[model samples]
Target: MSLEKLPPLLALVCLAVPGTALAVKPGGTLYIKAKNTHLKASSSPTADTLVVLQPGKEVTYDSREGKTPWYKVTVPVDKKGPVQGFVYQANLSVSPPSLEVTSKSPDKPLSPEAFASSGAAVKALGPGAIAYGKTLSRPDSVQQLIALESLAASIDTAQVAEYARAGGLPEVVGRPQVARRSPAKKKGGK
Candidate 1:
């Protein structure tokens, strides 16, 4: 290839190479999506927590590319200057999160402890999500969802490990497996 052609070819090759370039430029801003999340020293979840990032806080994007689950970022701490750390990508968003607090019935506000005790946060589906499910033309979608959730709940850690092994899932082979508590058995059903 000629010298002039090599330059264009190299550029194409670089672009074609996956995970080589940063998704966002270094120093570009990214907002924290979660209410609170830890900025870790490394990409892993078990890494040391460098700082706690709050919702809507802006952090400078450090070098990271492609489908990596973690984003390397520089967060500004009050006592400590700009601290470089890694945050899980799921905890971040490109746009700032809305800080507005909304309630269906403000006149009768629910207590935080009561809400926690209700277990609604984890189990209940929002009306909006249910409506979206309805729109997909499955009238019994809610029932199906509940059934699926029940099925998932019944699966123990051993079952999951066995399934992963039987399916030849290499990714889960060495990863720490979290054991789940067995669901409450029905009375006289054993």
Candidate 2:
């Protein structure tokens, strides 16, 4: 509104603008060696399936897929030969190797039947069963049991029992017995 106010406003605007002093330029290219002889172009680096890229092909890197460190690059060939492999960021950085969970103490082995059943439950219920199982396996208390019962109701009973059995519950209490005879039995039959 006034000359004095205009200088203050201009100074505020400059302060608000970040990195105004720095000359910004386009992003630069990165040169990376293939960590593996063959690398995979996945929808995301964490994807199970990988589109194979042959080793030693120098390709230009492109944008990232989210905040994940994965970089997408273009492949030179379409499914045919004289194919040049492309570059992508597979986020597979080297850190300390992961520790394997090996049983140290001699514990009783799991029954094959129980193992199979638990595996089936995991396949059927996906992450829900896994998460519920983790909660159920915690130190038992009245509240935990109540929570487990609620979670179990949301899952297939057979599957829940299977998981319970596998998780070292000596027996899954109150598992329903399979119905053998029909309710409408022959007249006078005991």
Best by lDDT: 1
Locate the minimum summed-lDDT window of 10 residues in model 2: 91-100
Using TM-score as the measure, the top candidate is 1
Alpha-carbon local distance difference test for all models: 0.64, 0.40
Identify the runs in model 2 with alpha carbons over 4 angstroms from their true place: 1-32, 35-51, 78-190
lDDT of 2 by residue, 3-66 (tens): 6888889888888985465422223333333222222334332232223332233344555557
Alpha-carbon TM-score of each model against the true structure: 0.41, 0.24
Model 2 score (lDDT): 0.40
Per-candidate count of clashing residue pairs (backbone under 3 Å) = 0, 0
lDDT tens per residue, model 1, 27-106: 78888765336676777655666666566788998877457788889888777478787887777777776533225544
